[model samples]
Target: MALASPTVAQAQSGTAAQCQTSGANSVPELHKEWILVGWDKPVAGQSWDFREKLGKYYDWEANDVVLYDDMSPDFQIARSPEEYRALWESSFQALRRAHHLVLNGPEVIAGDKLSTSTLEFAARLEPPESQPIISVRARSTLVWRCTSDGWRIVREHNSTRRITPEESRQLFGF
Candidate 1:
C-alpha cells in the first residue's frame, strides 16, 4: 500500500492543528501507523521500500537529529539521515518477517515546538530461510519537533532485552 503525500501547506497546517488539539496524545497512533507501514510484506524478489516514509517521519535535513539504539555498537551514533537509512535498511534486509506491537504507554510531554514520549513495544523478528525467530521487548523515547514539513522525529533512544519463547508466545500468541 502506498501512503499519500500531503502538500507542504497542508502538512504544515495539519501538524499545527494536531499539536494544538491532541498534542502528543496522537503520537502513539501515528507510531503504530508507521510500524504498520514498515511491516508491509515486500513483493517477491524485492526489498521493502521505506525511502518515502523515512523522509516523512524523520527530520533528515536537521543537523541536530540523533538516534541511539542498543542494538547498534556501543557509543555508535547515527547522526545523519544517510546513516539512519543504512541502519534500518540493513536490519530490514536481514528479516524475513517483522512484527512489532506497542505494549505500553507513550507517556507524553508536549510543548509548543517540541514533544517527548516514551513507548514500550514487543518485537518478533524472523530471519531468512528457516532461521530461529528472535523476540524482544523494548522501550524507546522519542523527541519530535514541529517543523515546516510536519511533526518529525529529531531524537530517539531505544533499549531492548530478549524475551523467552514462552514469553513471546504469551505476548503475541503466535
Candidate 2:
C-alpha cells in the first residue's frame, strides 16, 4: 500500500517520528522514511543485494536485543560481507515457518554519530507454537543515514507476533 504523505514537519514534530538533529545529522528522519521504503523495496545500491533482510542489520554493529547488547566484541566487529550474508540466509531459512516480524533501530548513544532509529516488527504462525508454519503478517523498523552513497540502513531489529487489523490500525493508523 502507498504510505501516507505526512510532511517533514509532521514527522519530526512527533515523538516517535523524529530521528534527525536539526543542526547535526539530518539522517534520523531520513532513516525513518528509508525504513518504510526498505519495506517497499531495496535500499541504497545493490552492494548487499545478495543479502536477505533477516540478518542484514548485522551489516552495522547494532542489535535488536535478540543478539548482543552494546559492547560485545562481536558487535564491535562484523564478519566479511560473504559471511554475513551466509548467516542472514541461515537465519531467514530458519524463520521460514514462522509468522509476523518486528525490528527496532538503534537509539543514539554518544559521539557525533547517531545510532539510527529502531526497526520494531512482529508476526504470527500457523500452528500457534512450536513446529508452526509462518503464514501471518510482519512489520519492522529500519534506520536510515545519508551516506557517501546515499540514504541507507545502519541498524535494525527483528521479531514475530500475531496482530489483528484493528491492532495494526492502532499501531500505524494505515
lDDT of 1 by residue, 35-91 (tens): 546544334334665576556677878899898888774557898666777777766
Q: How many clashes in candidate 1?
A: 0
Stretches off by above 4 angstroms in model 2 are: 1-77, 94-115, 125-130, 133-145, 154-174
| Residue-by-residue lDDT tens digits, candidate 2, 123-160 | 33223135643322333444443333333345433334
Q: Model 1 residue 120 lDDT?
A: 89
What TM-score fits each model? 0.79, 0.34
lDDT, candidate 2, at 51:
49
